[model samples]
Target: MNNRRLPSLTPEQCGSRILDAKCIVAFTGAGISTAAGIPDFRGPNGLYTTGKYNADKVFEIDYFHKHPEMFYEFSRDFIQILKKIQPTITHRFLARLESEDLLTGVITQNIDTLHHRAGSINIAEVHGSYWSASCLSCNQFIKNGATLDWWEEQMTQSPRSPVVLCPHCGGIIKPDVVFFGEPVRDLDKAETMIKSCDLLLVLGSSLTVYPAALLPQLTSASTIVVNQGDVMISFRQDMYFILSDLDAFFKKVIDFIDS
Candidate 1:
């Protein structure tokens, strides 16, 4: 839902701003991971449209409590998808910016952890990630380092066994990801970063989600949105919108910066 009466910017202009900025923060969403074979939430091939996966039951807390299997089934496929993909060009561009000290940090709604894998040091996962999980019964914690092995063991442990369960109390293991009715993770920190940055880069997000969507309003930082479609918010000043393929846009941006 875009109201296109606001001012627009070219890739070179946006790159010039980025090169001049002291602190550049990136805000990303599922669109960043779509090229990595991860489906967008409302996109055509997203979980909502797929007959095999029900978005309501997969993310709804009440539904999860009653039928956790539905979520685990989705998770199993999601984890497999992650295995087959690497970070996209956009992901690498942000990571390279971070490495060159041009980027302050990243604030992301994606749970893929692609930013982390791409070598971004500072990040805020507004929606929690699958990197870590905890036991619901005994509050037993599973560290990120152990997550993959643990997930693998459970999947092959038995055919009738639960997809994910606590080894200690046989309790269900819940990933740190935000479910429906759950508050976003690290909101306070994310807001602080957003407010402090000199530039806010919106990448691959529809900006339809609440609380997280309100972040841009909390800052007067120059905003640059690079995605394929419309974004919900339209700023009056210091804003730029580039509606194009993320990778192609970023390639142009990188060229502008290096030149």
Candidate 2:
């Protein structure tokens, strides 16, 4: 982790950063929600790095069919986190931006629905979320609470539990999340938001993951990056770069906006 601090830009400076842009887009990741106590998927204490569960095997579509328990274990914790966590200042700031007509939409890699919770209506969850589940066999959608109840029942019944069956047709049930091998749910909408934006603000991502990572580059707008550490993107000198805690930085920006 790089500890070197980049000079802080004032709220006026940050506000001016996007003043000329008509359409502003925000790209977010796990880091954006970390302030709300959600662990990032690939961060130091993340599922992959901590090795509590194999991210690749658990998230793989085929592998999930063979061993659904692993995914359930992961989902159990994630669901609990979702239940307890609140959206941070950054999330609220973005929502406020939309209200002010300064932001067009949000494109997030996070599966957590903090952006929505924070009151952002124009959001695209590129990686999907735990809010909804789907039946693989029947194509029926189930609410998250219903799926959790069914999963709990399975755990108590038998060691070799039956596959999650759709209530409608008795077919396989899966979360709406985009698994390792699965294609993203709404690529066209995501691309449309990115391409149409005049300013792109990327937050809390290392910019390593593809498809979602490629979005910032697709924007012809001026791109601003705010993260705790170094980013992988090739940002121009004119583009704003704020290397600091996301919540603190955004709080400052919000306060500046209020003033």
Candidate 3:
């Protein structure tokens, strides 16, 4: 998109655009949840690169099938982090927009369920999430998906469950998260939402991962990126870039909109 790009946008200006938009959709990444203590999988000090979690073992589908324990171990800690943290300002702002019928939906690459916790109902978790899990054997989802208490029960067992398994089939249970070889969960739905929107807000993502990263280009809508670091796409003339803190930028936008 080489139309006309603005290098920077004031919070008030962004707020004005949002208020004037009839349908706004947000595309978010792990950066949006980092402020809430959920670590990004690809950030500078993220799980993969930081050596805290092995991406090969955790995200590779074949590896997961072979050594489910490694992924389960990561899951144990991830659930704890999710339990202790709340959604960030940006998350709540989008939820508020959804409630007011201003935002159409959110297309998120994050596995963290903060968007749901923040009360955004029309969300497409393209990366999948821990909200649900299915058995390796029967391919049946945990009765009602999973709850914090369910995870707590599994993780905190006296001897600790070596692997989370399906209660019904006694098969290994895996979170619905998209593994390396797995296709993302909701691309078509998310694409339709993005294409139908008048405005697109990209929050906290570096835009490195694809094909999720390519969704922004699928829409001709005005695209605004709010990220702290480098994004994969070129600074196109048609898009807008705001290199700033996610929550900090949205705090100002929220203040303006709520005013």
TM-score (all chains, Cα) for each model:
0.89, 0.83, 0.89
Error of 1 at 113 (Å): 2.0
Model 3 alpha-carbon drift over 4 Å, by segment: 1-5, 40-55, 143-145, 157-160, 234-238
Clashes of each: 0, 0, 0
Model 3, range 1-259, lDDT digits (tens) per residue? 3212447798999999999999999999878988998765676876677686777678889998888888887787778878999999889999999999999999999888888889998888898987777888999877344666677786566245578766787888888889989888988899899889999998888777888998887777777888888777655444788888999999999889879
Q: Output the worst ten-in-a-row residue range by lDDT, candidate 2.
A: 1-10
**29: Cα error in model 2, Å:** 1.1
Candidate 1 vs 2: which has more TM-score: 1
Candidate 2, residue 72: lDDT? 75
Give the best candidate by lDDT: 3
Quickly count the clashes in candidate 2: 0
Candidate 2: where is the Cα deviation over 4 Å? 1-8, 18-20, 40-55, 143-164
